[model samples]
Target: MITGDNQHAAMRVANHLGIAPELVFFKASPSDKKTVIQKFEQEGEKVMFVGDGVNDSPAMAQASIGVAINAATDITVQAAGIVLMSNDLNDVLKALAVSRRTLRQ
Candidate 1:
């Protein structure tokens, strides 16, 4: 999880979500987020970026799968490959499950 939020707050959220501290990037700028996505892509990794603000647009566009929440900013929605109509973040899991099922078929 890469976030523009402060380190302490980002860490708290990462902990709650069971994300490892090494995987959490705090105080990240839009460019930083994009760079991270690019780096992962260079390493042959597929990145899925979930975001809801204009600041997230660039990174969203850079991701292999960009998911926008229903309440996300217009820019974020435009950049995302998938838009979740529901406000719940758990919808991301649902979308991934559906994608996996489709791929298996």
Candidate 2:
């Protein structure tokens, strides 16, 4: 996860999510998020970026799959490939599951 937040906050969220500390990018700007996605693409990785703030629009557009919450800014909504109707973050997992199932079919 790439975020503009400081290392402490970033680590806190990462730890809660069970993500590796090395995988978290702290003090990242929107452009930094885009760069991270680009780097992942260069490494042959598929990225799914989820965000809501206006600050997230560029990164959202840069992701392999961009997901936005319904309450996000218009710009974010426009940039996303998938916009969740509900603000619940768990819906992202559901969407991922459905996509995987569809792909298998």
Candidate 3:
């Protein structure tokens, strides 16, 4: 997770989600988040970014696939390829499942 939140707060949430410290980036500016996604793309990684804030727009536009929550800022939703109507992150999984099923046909 790349977030503008401070390290301490980010780490607390990360730990709860069982995310490794190495994979968590805290206090990242919008540009930093976009740079990280660019770096991953350069390394041949397919990145899927999920966010719901104005600051997340740049990175969201940079990702291979951007998922935005219903509560996201207008800019964020505009930047995303997929917009979830629900606030729950679990909606992302549901969207994925739907996509996979549609693609199989």
Best by lDDT: 1
Model 3: lDDT to the true structure: 0.94
TM-scores for all candidates: the values are 0.94, 0.95, 0.88
lDDT of 3 by residue, 22-48 (tens): 989999999999999999999999898
Off by over 4 Å in 3: none
In angstroms, the error of model 2 at 46 is 0.3
Task: Report the C-alpha lDDT of model 2 over 11-96, residue by residue, as the tens digit.
Answer: 99999999998899999999999999999989999999999999999999999999999799999999999999999999999999
Query: How much does each candidate deviate from the true structure in C-alpha RMSD?
Result: 0.9, 0.9, 1.5
**Candidate 3: Cα lDDT at 72:** 97
Worst 10 residues of 3 by lDDT: 91-100
Ranking by lDDT: 1, 2, 3
Which candidate, 1 or 3, has the higher TM-score? 1
